[model samples]
Target: MTPGARIAAAIDILDAITAGAAAEQALTQWARRSRFAGAKDRAAVRDHVFDALRRWRSAGAAGGGQSGRAVMIGLLREDGTDPAQLFTGERHAPEPLSHDEAQVPEPTPARGVRWNLPDWLLPEFAESLGAHAEATAQALQSRAPVTLRVNLRKASRAEAQDALQAEGILCAPNPLCATALTVTEGARRVKQSAPFAQGWIELQDAASQAVVAALPSGARCLDYCAGGGGKALAMAADGRTTFAHDIDAGRMKDLPSRAQRAGAAIRLLDRAGLEQERPFDVVLCDAPCSGSGAWRRAPHGKWTLTPERLAELTAVQDSILDTAKDLVGAGGHLVYATCSVLRRENEDRIAAFLAGHNGWFCRLEQRFDIQQHGDGFFTAHLTRVKL
Candidate 1:
């Protein structure tokens, strides 16, 4: 299909994407009906849809309206392209822009559009990040880097890089962690690449990899809230002997296959099983909270999250920590983590935990801010020092 056709298709998909439909779901639904759209067409259309989402507010401002067509026009304008070229009145292309639409508006940004965030979140970002707030907000407006964790058990960093490069995927060594690689080019082809099929690489963010890398290596470890078991897989890959459990046992259904593919062993346990396997060498709580730090990847969460909802998440986080604490041995480490950039969830929660547990002492480990390498993540290491 012609480039113009892709643009037209993107406009239709964007309507669904902006209206709360999952981006992947909207594209899949569009593909099901449009048999004429090829794989290339679908990928191109998806790019347009995500680009519009990444800069929705600014794009809406440039296009003079918030409709799908206007946002596409705004996107094209931002790229200095003539929208008429795509909105041509030809077959499968969008209808020609109206006379009023033909007039390119001034490049003015929406109020607080630079942050590319909802009005409610602007103050929160500022309060959380302080001086770096604007940069953090601006970073969320762009796509996140495609990061991979080199299965060190399978291959060395240099070996993995060479292997992936041969398969047309360019990966750069990430400074965040020894096992992390940032896919600089051909990232979209990774899933179909030979290395991926062989499980030489796992699509995990560098920041997430860093969190597990910081853990004190132990023979027995438990990921107390192992949602999807990504961190559990990474910890297992490091050969620390990993076990995974979630309050909802169903969340770990795919973990067995994922672990097998990555050549890592993860023991899946339900809440009852976790209770039976107490006093582990290390207990990790990658707790749930407002995913503000990860808004770039899951943009919908930013708009959906509310103050009340955040409060509820923190309560759950605390409970997870309290429950998981009992599973750690007398000399074991109880690690706390969250995807939230908010102080209330990260530092504040840790403070509250220390206050509640008289004998516990925090190791005050590293924290990662959201940037090009990965999403915003916080991890703190603590150990039981007393009765």
Candidate 2:
């Protein structure tokens, strides 16, 4: 397909999203219907749609409307590209911009519009991030880096790098974690690479890998909220006997296969099984949140999150911390973590947990800010106050 054709496709998908269809659902439906579109065409269209979603507010303001065409025009303007190039009246291209659409509006001075976030979230971001809020919001407007964690049990980071390079997938060491590699090129081919097929690497953010690397010494570890078991696999690779449990057991259905591929042993547990396997040396609660830090990968989340939903998530985080702490044995460590930059989900939750639980005290706390290389993350280590 021509570049114009891709932009037209993106406009249609974005329109569906504006009409309440999920971004992924709209993209998938379009792909299924447009059998003539090639892989490159599909990828390009998807990128355009996500870029528009990431800058929804700013794009709407610049284009003077919220329609898909207007958003595309605004997005192009923001990127310094003339909308005329892609909105040409050629076959398979979007309709030519209207006279009004052609006139770019004056820049919006509202921080929420400038930051490409909802108006309600400005105070939350400021409260959570202070001086770094605007920069972090800007970072979410771009693409996230593709990163992989080397399975040290299968190959050293150097050996994994060599194997990936042999397959034409270029990567460089990520500074955030010793085991992480930021994919510099051929990111689309990573899943098909021999090293990945052989379990030498797993797709994970560098900040997520660093959370595991910072874990204290422990013989047994339980990932208390182990959705998909990424951290569980990392813990097992670090030479700990790892166990994984989630309230929804179905979330762990693929964990056994993933564990096998990584040559790591992770025992999956239901509520009953978790009770039987209690008293772990370390318990890691990577609880759910609004996912603000990694919005680059899931931009729709930033738009969909509401104050009520955020309150629900905070309650869940607190409950998970309360429950997981009891499973830690004497002198054991209980670690709380989230992929959110909001203080309500990170520092505030920790403070509430410590206030309610008398015998526990925090030992270490770290925050990974959103960067060109890694997602934002927070982790805190807590230990019992032995009298």
Candidate 3:
């Protein structure tokens, strides 16, 4: 497909999303109907649509209207692309820009549009981030850097880096975590890389890896809220005997396969299984929350969260911690972690845990900010001293 044609496809997908269809659903429907579009064409079209979504408000403003054509115009204007040259009404290309559409407006900035976030979140960002708020907010406006965790059990960092590079994927050591590599180029080819196929590397944020890296090592470990088993897999690579448990067993269906590929033993446990595997030396809860720090990777989540939903999420985080605490034995460690930058979810929640539970002592508090080459993340270690 031509450049103009890809922009046209993106417009249709954006319209579908604005009409209440999910982004992925709209993309999939478009792909299914247009089997003639090659793999590269489909991927490029998808990228354009997501870029527009990431800056939806700014796109609408620049385009002068919220219609499909307007968004494409806005996107082109934002890129300083000539709409008349691209949209010449050629085959598969978008229609020609009308006389009014040809006049691209000067790039004026609004606070929310500048931040690439909703209006309600600006104050929250300021409160949570202080002086670094603007930089962090600006960071979320663009695509996030992709990082991969080199599985030590399978290959050394040097070896994995070489393998990935041979596949046309460039990576450099990420400073946030020793085990992580920031993909500088060719990230689009990572999945097909031999290192990834052989399970020598797994896609993980540098901050996420650092959170697990800071944990106290133990042979017996439990990931209490092991959603999709990312942390569990990380733990397995750290040479721990890991057990993963989530309330919803359906979420862990592919974990066994993933672990098999990694050649690691991560037992998936249901509620009953967790009860049976009582008293692990370490219990880790990477709880669910607003995911504010991860908006760069999953921008749609930022738009969907509300104050009420956050309240509900905090309640669930508390319950998960309460349930996980009992699974730790005497002299064991209970670690709480969240990918949220909000104080209410991080420091405040840990403070409440310490206040509510006597005889527990805080051991370590580790926070990786958004500028740390990955998403912002917080983790605290609390050990049962008196028990």
Using TM-score, give the best candidate's number: 2
For each candidate in the order shown, give its overall lDDT on alpha carbons. 0.85, 0.93, 0.85
Mind giving the per-residue lDDT tens digits that candidate 1 earns over 274-328? 7788879989899988887887887767756788898898898888888888888
Candidate number of the best lDDT = 2
Local accuracy of candidate 2 as per-residue lDDT tens digits, 33-56: 999999888989999999999999
Winner on lDDT (2 vs 3): 2
Model 1's number of clashes is 0
Residue-level lDDT tens digits of model 3 in 1-387: 898888889889888887878888989999999999998999899878877777777777788777778877887777777677789789789888888887767666778877777888788888878998888877766777899999999999989999998888999999988999999989889988889888999999999999898888677999988888889999998999899988777888888988988889998887788888888989999999898888777777776778889889888887877778888888889999999988778888888888888878889987778874899899999887743
TM per candidate comes to 0.94, 0.98, 0.94
Question: Which of the two candidates, 1 or 2, achieves a greater TM-score against the reference?
Answer: 2
Instruction: Give per-residue lDDT, candidate 1, residue 310.
Output: 81
Q: List the candidates ranked by TM-score, beginning with the highest.
A: 2, 3, 1
Which candidate would rank higher by TM-score, 1 or 3?
Answer: 3
- Give the residue spans of candidate 3 off by over 4 A: 106-109
